[model samples]
Target: MRAKVTVMLKNGVLDPQGEAVKSALGALGFAGVDAVRQGKVIELDLAETDAAAAEATVRDMCEKLLANTVIESYGVEIL
Candidate 1:
C-alpha cells in the first residue's frame, strides 16, 4: 500500500519563514502576491496489507514522529 502524508502549520500560527519568502517575492517584483506558508509532504510505501491498516500506521507515524501536532495538522491518504 502507498500512503501520502502532508504536514503543515495550522492557521493562526505566525509563519515567519513564510513571511520572509513573501517579502523576497515582493523584492523580486512579483506583484499582487499576498503571503506564503511552507509545509512538507511525505510519501510512504507500507508492507501492510490494506488501506485501512496503512492509514492507521501512517497516522501513528505522524503523531509519534513525523509531525508536531501541538501546532500542526496532518492528513493521511492511502493509495
Candidate 2:
C-alpha cells in the first residue's frame, strides 16, 4: 500500500516562510499574487494491504509525529 500525507499550518497561524515567498514573487514581477501558504507532502510505501488499515495507520502517524496537531493539520490518502 501507498500512503500520502499533507501537512499544513492551521488557519490564523503565522507563516513566515510563506510570506517570504510571496514577497519574493512580487519582487520578481508577479505582483498580482495575493497570498501564499506553504505545506508539505509525505509519500510512504507501506506493507499493509488493507486500505482502511493503511489510512488509519497514516492518520495515527500524522497525529503522533507527522503533524504538530496544535498549529498544523494533516490529511492522509491511500493509493
Number of the top lDDT candidate: 2
- What global local distance difference test value does model 1 have? 0.91
lDDT of 2 by residue, 1-49 (tens): 9999999999999999899999999888996898899999999999999
Per-residue lDDT for 25 in model 1?
94
Cα lDDT tens digits, model 1, 1-79, are: 8899999899998888889999999999999987799888999988998888788889999999999999989999898
TM-score of 2: 0.97
Residue runs of model 1 more than 4 Å from their true location after superposition: none
Highest TM-score model number: 2
Least well predicted 10-residue stretch by lDDT in candidate 2 = 26-35
- Assess the local accuracy of residue 24 in candidate 1 as a C-alpha lDDT between 0 and 100: 95
Off by over 4 Å in 2: none
Q: Give the total clashing residue pairs for model 2.
A: 0
- TM-score per prediction, in order, is 0.91, 0.97
